[model samples]
Target: MATLNFKHLRYFWMVAKTGSIARAAEQLHLTPQSISGQLTEFSATLDVELFRRAGRNLELTEAGRRILSYAEEIFTIGDELLEVLRDQKVKKTLPFRVGIADNVSKLIAYRLVEPALKLGEQVRLVCREGRLASLLAELSIHRLDMIIADRQMPANLNVRGYSHLLGESGLSVFGTSGLAKELSGSFPALLDNAPFLLPGEDVAIRPKLIEWLETSNLRPRIVGEFDDSALMKAFGQAGAGLFVAPTAIVDHVCEQYKVSVIGRIDAVVEHLYAITTERRLTHPAIVAISKAAREDIFGVGKD
Candidate 1:
């Protein structure tokens, strides 16, 4: 009903998106009191009740929800406009937020993202690790620029996203030096009754690993199951059990974790994908990652 102050609208939008003014303040780099003052003024200017408190969180009122819809659209369009005008010459660093699925090896994720940093100082990389479904939810809401996952987007998800195959690599079984030496006998046959650390059922490679083990007629004793690949590797490094990792990072893993390769699982490959909302990649940082992954990073299985 009155002339809009977009600055106030932006504060409100951030608060609404984040669910609390304090959290929004943290993201916007402002004090909570200052944001609260701005929000009070904003509500006064509009002569509408914007929020209602619900426990520790702020619940949007009917008017607030309506306003948020417009605010999100406004900011999204504003973002698109800025993207179109963005240039390397511009001093402002563009934020590229990526979500890495927890099951993905940290070594592989770092390699996939390292190329983006080497491109230039113009990109600000922000990384978050979580489950693929959670990351997909964030992507659907535009909270994440992209997600790194071991597989393609599920066909059942209602969220719209494009899966870009960055690269794929076969896996390798690894164990501590002493453990590997002890188990060194005859390939898959040596795996029989060997202490094995398996990926959790939620992981894409878990079933593949089970199938491989069964087909090879090797029944390794399950030492533990882990949802976090890095943690699983740590267990393997400590001689807790043998674990599997992407062969593309075999050397890196051996050096970092002080482990030795027991064998290679070339039949079961792990595919990496960059899942984004756009079918065509427009983000320069992401483009660099894709190029590097396909050309240099996972170009060949290290095994």
Candidate 2:
């Protein structure tokens, strides 16, 4: 196979960014034919088609999107290098990329990651939110430095990673003022036959919640289900139904969404984990996050 060509890669990146060979040619001060030939050679070298024609426009293929992500990082680093060499006082900012599971409470996620930004070192924090499986895939490829999730990495997954328990928080149910008034009963009894919003089955808490409801013999009317915790809270805030959040962030959730707490369920606990490629946490940002979560946020040591 031919070695990678930075020149061809640069041309391909420009074409991808401009969405047209002609536009890229104009920007690079080159002929359209020259840009087209470079892209063709680049694609052939990579053994993948980067773009597909869509009407009069070009759309990136899956392979193209993946390559574009790398290209963006490459060009960003190149620009930073130039700045550092050109200016003696300039300091390079360390990039800390974290993947957050969608089902994790947004407030809890923010609190867990907030400490990393406060660290003395200048850092560029990039947070990507998605499903656990998808985020784990990104982490496996070294695209993400760490992943924050409700559950630990599954044993069945082939990815090699260590799960560090951040801390656990009991569940707290909340509802709009009207709903709270309407369902005025003591504790779990108030939840019986009450309209409820809940996390989808894909969320780690869903199964535990279901089991708890069944054990309590409380059959709440299921009004809505959500894969995203934020969306579930939004619906709950609008008086759609009652929803549960981690007690660790109950105050913030209530303040932000203007919801009232219906009750707390200590039995239905939520556990948070930080999954990283390293068995022992060593990264400065990661260490700061772990320390803050245990000492401040959750107020408990690792499990």
Candidate 3:
């Protein structure tokens, strides 16, 4: 029997986590050819076929699944051992890595995560903004400490992650002062035939907002659709159209975007979630974010 190759095992682990050799190679800072060769060598050493193609993705064979389970344990323990060692270093800066899902409001994200910087310790805050599925991939590979998302982990996703509800916020409609002034009649009635800027179809709030509009029987002409909530707010600031934003950070939005709230829609709520690999949050930054979101931002934790 030959001695085990820890490097090969690590490569396999990364590929399994990312579900692509190219992605794993990118993370490892190695060439795809190099990793491909190494993977071949690793499989030959073990004398087993580890992967088979399933559509565009690489599916682990039964043997590969067994190997991956062992690899996960090995690498996870190795990472913890390194973390324990790193913690002993005095005044060492802790890396606080977070991913913000694209659908989440930037204003709310900033407020929820800002408390981590004031933890009175040396902490480096790094944030990556992307789609929820992409952020979940990063979370599964341990590249991100946690994900700040508008939704929870999808049940169909194979990644093992837990979602902690930060809190929910009802929505508010905002428009420029001139636009708000021009609107006639009362509340929902005023919104009919009004110009509107809506979140993109891919966004979690888009469907809910549509349903609310349908239920209320108000159909504002959608002047524009934006994937970036911040960008949508910018258009709203310019009097392009009225837009909806979470009421939790409505004050910040109104101030920053220089818009006036036309009305509040308590029926449509945006549920915020913190998605992480661990069920019980252990990271100080994550803990701080969850606490601040519930108590300060969403006003749920307070008595």
TM-score of each: 0.74, 0.96, 0.72
lDDT of each: 0.89, 0.92, 0.89
Q: For residue 259, what is the lDDT in candidate 1? A: 90
Q: What lDDT does candidate 2 reach at residue 302?
A: 40
Candidate with the greatest lDDT versus the true structure:
2
- The most accurate candidate by TM-score is 2
Candidate 1 clashing pairs, residues 3+ apart or interchain: none
Error of 2 at 253 (Å): 0.1
Candidate 2 lDDT at 221 equals 97
Per-residue error for 83 in candidate 1, Å, reads: 20
Please, what are the lDDT tens digits per residue for candidate 2 over residues 1-303?
A: 778888998888898898898899999999999988888888899999999998877889999999898988999999999999999788788899999999888889899998898888788899999989899999999999999999999999999899999999899999999988898679999899999997998788899999999999999999999989999999999999999999888889999999988899999888999999999999999999999999889997545
Q: Give the lDDT of residue 183 in candidate 1.
A: 78
For model 2, name the residue pairs that clash.
none
Clashes of 1: 0
